[model samples]
Target: MASEESLEESKKKVYRKEQALKRTAESLEDDEEIELPRKRYYRQRAHSNPFSDHELIYPAKPEDMKWSMLYGGSNEAPTVADVGCGFGGLLVSLSPALPKERILGIEIRVQVTQYVLDRIHALRKQNQGKEVDYTNIACLRGNAMKFLPNFFGKGQLKKVFFCFPDPHFKLRKHKARIISPTLLSEYAYCLRPGGIVYTITDVKDLHDWMRSHLEAHPLFERLSSEEEESDECVKIMTTATEEGKKVARNGGSKYIACFRRTENPK
Candidate 1:
């Protein structure tokens, strides 16, 4: 059993480590911009919040989280988080599928983030007293890589999605790639035992890279092809994601992998 003093020290360590990540990530912001290919994209909705007198189902701290209350009933609702959630596609879609408090959408882009916020607000206004309640989806404009630990405690998040993350194709720019050993550690840290990390990309090379890293990760167990196929929850790479749809329309084949977080090594 961990002593009180040991637990306090652990919390302090977690805070310090998070700060270190922020400092190191600062370097990524200095890269020069280039005229990138203008991929076909959709426009974002305007900004507005529609919730009126909404109460927080759980306290700000993850330690204060109550799973039973968060899910309203005996059904185990997945506290799903869409990391690198761009334009709120997956977040908004999954919101109606589950309880409002259980779905969180996190994105870094300020403009798109505000757009999603407005879109949800519009949704809420449109669905007043309806079965499709939009309050289940909330968008936060912040870096997912750093804010992940701040919002969630160890073993709290159930499903984490990294749908079509920036590949950062160059070898020299691999660190900028979203999937890495360090990032995977943070993903594993947030996930409860048996929680899964799902990733999809149209880039074949990036797909292989993600598979290699996740498979080699100590905290993750690679799901067998048969297991992945059998699990309805872990469905195949789909056009559900905005980027996935774009890639699919372009005749690109999506590659996907799912890894379950096993128990901490003794």
Candidate 2:
């Protein structure tokens, strides 16, 4: 009886392993469909450590990056980056507003980034003949925290948006929150003097944390409430992103903190 029971348990374990493998296969199949063109063209890399695979997404130098390929051979480089752009809502809304300025959205998730790419492709096709071409905006899969400087030249960016960023609420995970001292230094390096860093979140603790860090950073100075209110981009950022819309629907309060890159560290 003991030997029979042992055999039965072993069989159950094997069955469970088979079920897990089946689920994993199904997930991979779904991912393949979603990541079609990218899966075919680009080599896949681990999402956790973006810098580990240096050749995956970024060019060696910002100047070496082919903006033309993405923006229809336009010589002008992107002056704005929407970090962690999910579903590309903010980029879509900002495209019409800043008709001339090139904008790039960097997202980490494979399927979400692919969805944004497809969304942009559809929008561009829809408005092919219109005066306002969305060729100014593009999306790419990137880990912004690790590879920000890899993409933008020093003082190349005029605006950086951190709209509804992931709030790493745990005390231990705060370093991953994206607005750290080290990351702020990188942000300051990429942003032109007097350029803006716009941040907003529905999470109050996260908002406070971001504000305090920016305030403490020598290179950044907090924007006055009036100045923030006057900026058109702020308004769009507040209402444009998917997170922003969800916050609005739920009547949740959003905390905004805008900072300017100073000419010299204070």
Report the number of the highest-lDDT candidate: 2
Candidate 1 local lDDT, residue 53: 25
lDDT of 1 by residue, 192-219 (tens): 9999898888889999999999999999
Instruction: Give the TM-scores of the predictions, in the order they appear.
Output: 0.69, 0.79
Candidate 2: where are CA atoms >4 Å away?
A: 1-55
- Once fitted onto the true fold, the runs of candidate 1 whose alpha carbons sit more than 4 angstroms away are 1-78, 230-237
Q: What overall lDDT, based on C-alpha atoms, would model 2 receive against the true structure?
A: 0.82
In candidate 2, position 156 carries an lDDT of: 94
Model 1 C-alpha RMSD vs. true structure (Å) is 16.9
Residue-level lDDT of model 2, residues 142-163, one tens digit each, is 8888878888999999999999
Candidate 1 at residue 260, lDDT?
95
Lowest lDDT 10-residue stretch of candidate 1: 32-41
TM-score of 1: 0.69
Q: State the lDDT at 164 in candidate 2.
A: 89
Tell me which residue pairs clash in candidate 1: 100-136
